[model samples]
Every structure is written in C-alpha cells, then in structure tokens.
Target: MITVFSLIAGMLLTGMNYLVYRQLIVSFLSKKTGLVCISVITICTVIYISGLRIVELPDFLYKTGAVCLGLSFMLFVITLFYMAGKWLFRQVSLPVNQRKRRFLSLCFKGAIVGAGAGYVSTGIYSGKSLPRISTIPIKIANLQRPLTIAQITDIHLGVFLQKDFLQAIVHLTNEQDPDLVVITGDIIDMPPEAIGDTLDPFGQLKTRYGVFCVPGNHEYYYGVNGILARLAQLGITILGNRTKQIAGINIAGVYDLAALQLQRGPFPNLEAALETRDPALPTVLLAHQPKFIEHVTPDHRIDLMISGHTHAGQIVPFSLLVLLDQPYLHGLYHHDSITRIYVSSGAGFWGPPFRCGAPAEIAVLQLTEEHRSASFLRK
Candidate 1:
C-alpha cells in the first residue's frame, strides 16, 4: 500500500514539475535548459522522499530530503494557484495584442517563481521550530473538578525527531501541570531497533491521571507492539478500543482507521470501545483521526472527543488537498450538537519537516463546569 501510494504521489509530482517547467520556466530559459533543470531536480527529490521510507539516511541528508520534497510540493501548488488567478483575470479583462500578452505572461511567471521560492524558504525555517500551546477550556456537566489534558499527537518519532525534541515536548507538557496526557497516535514511524530510547522522555511526564495512548497509522508501519511496550514501560496506559475511568471521566480510545485497512488488529470497534460505560459520567474519546467524529452517534451521548492525525495539512495549499480525505482540517468542531470534537494540528510532522500554513501545536484542553466551552488560536 505504501509503495502504491508513493507511486501515485510520484506521478502527480512528476506531472506538476513538467507543467511548471513548460509553463513557467520556459518563459525565462530555453526549453532544453528548463527541461534539464526540472528533470534533474525532480529526479533527485523523488529519490530523497522515497529513500525516507526504504532506508535509513544520515540526519543531514534526511532533513535535506524532507525539505526538498516540501519545497517542491509547495512551489508547485503556489505556482498553480498563481496561474489560476491569472487565468481568472484574463477571462474578465479585455483581450490584448501579442506583445502585451507576452509581457504580462512573463511578469506572471516571474512572480510565481519569486513568490514560490520565498514561501518555501520560509516554510523550511518555520517547520523545525517548537510548537505553541493552545489553551482550550471545555465544560463537562459531570466533571467535579477542573481537568487539564495535554494532547500530543502525530509526533512521527524517527529520523526527523530525536530524544531532545521529545524531552522538550515533555518539558512543555509537564509545565502545564496536566491532569492527564493523551497521545493520539502517529507516535513512532520507524522500526523498534531504530527507535531505541528516543521516547524515554515520556517517563518524565508529570500528569496526575497518568497518560493514555491510542494507535495511529504510523505505529502499524514500524512495530506497534514494541512502541506500545515502550510507552507502557513509562507507566502509560494503552487504550486500543478500550476505556479507562480516571477520576470522574470515562476516557475511551479507538485505533486509527489504518488499523482496519492494514488488518493489524481488530478493526476499530467504536461500539466496543464505548460500551458498558456510565452514561451519567461525561465521556471523552481519544481517537487518532478527527474523522472518527463521524462514527459518533447522538445516542452515544459522548461529551468530547480528541484527535490528531491530519497535521492540519502541515503545509498551505497542501492543506486544501488534505480536505479531500478529512472532514475537518483542524481546530475544534461541534458535532451532532451533542459531541464536541477537537482535531489538533498534531504536535509533530510526518515526511515533510516544514509546516507551511499549519503550525504544530500541543493542545491543553480543560474540562470543567465553571467556564463555557471555548477555543482560541493565540499563535
């Protein structure tokens, strides 16, 4: 499945590069030169991205490849948008002679190149930075005292992120003095041997109710059992289609949709995960993908659901494409008028290191009866 998806993505990227070369690059240079430049760079980039999955690379090369792929995709998308806007303008404006048309075309091409370069450059710089903490207040009718849960998700721990980054995240989460910490999946993306003690930082988490984790698609790719065991050693509970009652809240967790598709374990049984619960107690479900909100029914009477998988598209125009699969790209949403689902932008990234428009976040959700439920994006 990974190979198939990679091939499809490779084809799409190839087509985009070709189009950019012909439509934009050709305006500045000879066709032969443009073709050579695009072809060489495109080939190298594809290799870099594909290499990330096949073999382990040096940190420098790995980061370089990741940035290369992100910059390529961003430039293509921005150029496409620019061309679209220009076409729309041409449709509305009067026709011009060949000379004027050529000049305008050249100007548009230059703008696309310049703007795309600047955008990608900025993305590379911003992507590696630490995320901000989004403090959200949620009211649960049954909660006795205020509860704070620090949600960490999609931290694809492998080549891109190491123990230092994980420690920093743990430090940040601990500073919040959360009651519970929930990992919404995509935790480990490499093999068990490769991971080693990189996740030891979790041992330092300072949560009262302890930590709970749900499997993301990336977990299945590496070694879910090993990864889960590592988390377990740190005194964290693994909730795979299971529920744990801590304090007065029923926290139920379901596996990601990838579990069913990959046939790694029993498909996500939302019913089983949610069954035999105290209906009176406000229920909080930890699901990896935000789309899991769709499985939630009004009869379930779930008060809140937390998820992080989309990475909020991780990049700009790319986020628009993420919408093709995900119902809500990011942020908090009121589903079914009874359940409030919050889809975090994820604490880490996937393949591409750079986050274009979507910033990484560690969401601190407060469940209390005092304040009305509200969310804010301060950063």
Candidate 2:
C-alpha cells in the first residue's frame, strides 16, 4: 500500500514539474536561461524523489534530497501565488492601459515570488537557536515538592537540522533543570540511516527523571521498530500506549493518531493506565496530536495533556485548516476543572520548513501544590 501511494505521488509530482518547466521555458524566462533553469529544476526534482525511495544512497544524499523536496514545495507555492495574483488582477478594473497592466502584473508576480524565496531562505538559514521558553505554573493537590517538566515536540531531525541544532535544544532545555523532560514526538524525519548522526545530540540531553517520548506519525513513516530501537539506545523511553509514574505524578502516553487508527485497541484506555494512581493525584498525558482529546472526557481524572503535531499549521492559510480540524490548535484549554490540554506549536518544522505566525517553542510546566491564588502565565 505504501509503495503504491509513493509511486502515484511520485508520478503526479513528475507531471507537475514537467508542466512547470514548459510554462517557465515558454512564458517566464529567456530562451537560454530557461533551458538552464528547466534542466536544473528537473534534475533536482528527479534526484530528490529518487533519493526518497532509494534506500542505498549515502545518508548525506538522502538528507540533501529531503531538503530539496522542501525547497521544491516552496517554489511550487510561489508559482501558485503568482498564478492566483494574475487571475485576481484580471477581474478588477485597473487604473491603467494594457501596457501598464502587463507591467504591473509582472511586478506583482516578481514581488510574490521574491517574498516566497526569501521565506524559504530564512527557514533554511535559521539554524536551531535557543527555543523560546514559555513557563506555565500549575498546582496539584497532592504533590509534595515543586516539579518542573520540560516538554518539546516535532524535532524533525533528518534534514535542515544538525547536531548543532539539537545541541541548542538540549542546552535550552537543560537550562530549566527540569525534573523530567517529555518529547511529544516526530523527533526524526527519515529512516535511521539518514538521521543517525543528526540525532546524536539528543543523547546529551540531561533530565533527572529521564526523557519520555511517544511516537508521532513521522516515526511510523520511518519504520517504527527501527526508530524505537534507536531512541531506546539514546536513553529515551518509549511509552507506547502505556503509563509510568514519576514523583507521584502519573505520566501516560499513546501512539500517534495514525497508529491509533490502525491499532485502535490501545487508545481511549487512560483508565487502565491510571489504574494504580489515586484519584486525588494529578495525571499528565502525552499525546502526539491534539485531536485525540475528542475521545477523552473531562471526567477522566486527567489533569493535563500535552501534545504537538499540528505545528500550528506552520504556514498562514494552512493554519486556518488546522484550526478547523483541532479543537485546541495552539495554547492551553481547560476541559472543565479536572482536565486541561496544552498543545505546543511544535519545537521543529515539517514540509517547507518555514514558520510564519508559529514559532518553535520549549514548554516548561511547573507543577506545584494547589493554592487559592495559583494562576497561569503566558510569556
């Protein structure tokens, strides 16, 4: 099934590239430069798509292919915007003659294309820096000590990210001196061969209670068993549809939404995971996608749930689509007094790599004893 989809998508992309090449050569660029650009684009696309399928390529080439794919998609969007602008302008009466309108159309397309290219460049060049930390203080009734939990998600490490980026994430996370660190998944993009070295820095992260992770859809895309083994080797615990206890706080995690669809029995089982926990103690759940909350209820005794995977849409109009799909696209939402859900915009990016309104983040959750005056702060 996967192979069939890959083949169909590959053919469709190839056809689109051919059409784009024809349009560029015949209408957009000068004869000589058009040929050159067309050849370059075609070669790049072919090499990239081929690399995505060829398992034997050197790891660096595979990573390069992933980056090129992102660039190609960005370029496609630029073309789309240009086409849309042209169609929109034709509908309105311009305060100019045909010649002037032609010039304006060219200028408008140039501007849009330039803006898209600039965004792609920025996304690519913005090396992983210290992620912005937003700390939310929560007080539980039965917790004896103040506990700080750091949550990060969607560190898609295969391409456009390196050890330096991972190191920066680790440094920023360690600065909080978290008692426990939870990664809500999509930690790596490609297969282990493509990202093994790029993921090494994760091994350096220090957490007193250790790092816990649930698989994201991308992990399944990369081969779940292989990724799990590698994560285990790096000292990260994989909580696949299971629960664990830390300092009296029950931490439970479920597989990605895609996994749940394929393996339905594991999820909607918070009751089973929390069987040993007293009803008075606060429980935290790590779910990869925010939509999973639809299957849960406020009466589940789940105090807080952390999730990522939407990337807050990662782009503008696309984010609107996400809002329609997710109840809590980004930020915290209280489901009655017993259950609260916080959805991270994600610490890393996917697809085109650019993030518009959504910035990467590292969430610090300070769990304290419940007090009358306790409140949540947004930074």
Candidate that would win on lDDT: 1
lDDT (10s digit) by residue, model 2, range 1-379: 5466556767766666656555433456776776676556555655666655554456666555555555555556666766677689889989668898788868886787679768776656542334589787775666767889899898787556667877888889998999999999888877776565676777888888889988787887777778877888889988776778777778888777776655632343555655665565678888888888886786777878889888877755467778787777777777566677788877877755566557788898888875522345222
Candidate-wise lDDT, in order: 0.81, 0.72
Error of 2 at 25 (Å): 7.4
Q: Which prediction has the highest TM-score against the true structure?
A: 1
Residue range 1-379, candidate 1, lDDT tens digits: 6677667777877888888786666767899998887786677677776675666677777766676677568757776777796788678763468888778777777777788778887777767888789988876777867899999998887777778988999999999999999999998777777777888998899988889999888888777888888889888899988888888889999878887778777468888998867777889999888778888898888899998888888988678778888888788777766788888998788877888788999999988887664444211
TM-scores of the candidates are 0.89, 0.77
Model 2 poorest ten-residue lDDT run: 370-379
TM-score of 1: 0.89
The collision pairs in model 2 are: none
Which 10 successive residues of model 1 have the least lDDT summed? 370-379
Off by over 4 Å in 2: 11-27, 31-43, 46-56, 95-106, 127-130, 136-146, 189-204, 221-237, 260-269, 315-317, 320-328, 335-337, 351-357, 368-379
Clashes of each: 0, 0
| Clash pairs for candidate 1 | none
